[model samples]
Target: MAKTTLSLLPLILCLLYISGTAASANFIKASCSATAYPAVCVQSLSVFATTIQKSPRQLAQTALSVSLARAQSTKSFVTKLTKFKGLKAREYEAIKDCLEEMGDTVDRLSKSVLELKRVGKARGPDFLWHLSNVDTWVSAAITDGNTCMDGFAGRAMDGRIKTSIRARVTNVAQVTSNALALINQFAAKY
Candidate 1:
């Protein structure tokens, strides 16, 4: 009996591991489905699934951090682009505009982070209000990113710069959208 039990132990462990992974994936999918960009939401937040442990507040905080980090990186990228040689006046202006927008985006995300923290301490209706603030700020951050992208529309710039800026800003927007959705989900529970 001991020998048979020992032989089954590894199989049992493997099955448990697989089951845990499946459950984690399902949880991420369910949470991300609340967002507009579900695939991006899942991809961004799934990495932290184990650590997040299915806490809606933790999920919102994680999403905010991710969005803020991406916005900071993209802001830096756009600032550097302003220095690139041979840029036309319009291109330089566009880059500057994007830099300002990114700054605002970062600010909104920072506010959302604070709002999420407040949600933990506040009680009842106050908690709900804080969550609503977080959702609104995150949504505004997404809009800021989109407005930055719109600033570049129809501009005849170098393909490389255009593609790089668009990709980075789009990524920031998507993560911000996810953060808003997570905050909304958290609010809905209360």
Candidate 2:
């Protein structure tokens, strides 16, 4: 009986470790689930869980960086879309409008990244100010992405173009919204 109990101890410890790991992974998914697009949030952020740990500020900064990169890439994609040949006048107009809004989104995301960086280095009362800036910029980025999609609403554009643009813009918006939620969470800790 004593031998059996000792043998089971190792198994119990291993089970405990496994459970703890699963809980940690669930923590990341739970945080992501708080966003508008839980799947996107989890996919984009889960990779950074080890580095992010439980730091709200780190999570916010990482989210901002992801959003910035996506916005920049989408901006480039939309720019090329504008130059696509054989577009009708209205289609061209819609794409052009989308391009402009995407540009704004990119710019706002860039600003958020910068502000988040500042927030990371800040250690005084000014931290709140920098954090607030990050929140505002991320919100603006989300709005910019939405505005881009709004341009396509009711427009008689090619179905392919419309779908492609909507997917890209929605991806950016989801990421930005995730960043904003993280920023707010961090701010509340202050």
Indicate which candidate wins on TM-score: 1
All candidates' TM-scores? 0.85, 0.82
Task: Write down the RMSD of candidate 2 (Cα, Å).
Answer: 4.2
- TM-score for candidate 2: 0.82
lDDT over C-alpha atoms for residue 156 of model 1: 74
Error of 1 at 156 (Å): 3.0
Total clashes for model 1: 0
Regions of model 2 farther than 4 Å from truth: 1-24
Per-residue C-alpha lDDT of model 2 across residues 1-190, encoded as one tens digit per residue = 9999999999999998667656656776777777777788778987777667666777778888898899889889999988888987888888898888888888888887887888767877889888777778778778888878776777465489899988888888888888788778777787
**Candidate 2 structure lDDT:** 0.81
Worst 10 residues of 1 by lDDT: 150-159
- lDDT per residue (tens digit) for residues 83-167 in model 1: 9999888778888999999999989888888889888999988987887787777878888888887767784765777789999
Q: Candidate 1's error at 90, in angstroms? A: 0.6
Model 2: how far is 28 from its true place, Å?
Answer: 1.6
Which pairs of residues collide in model 2?
none
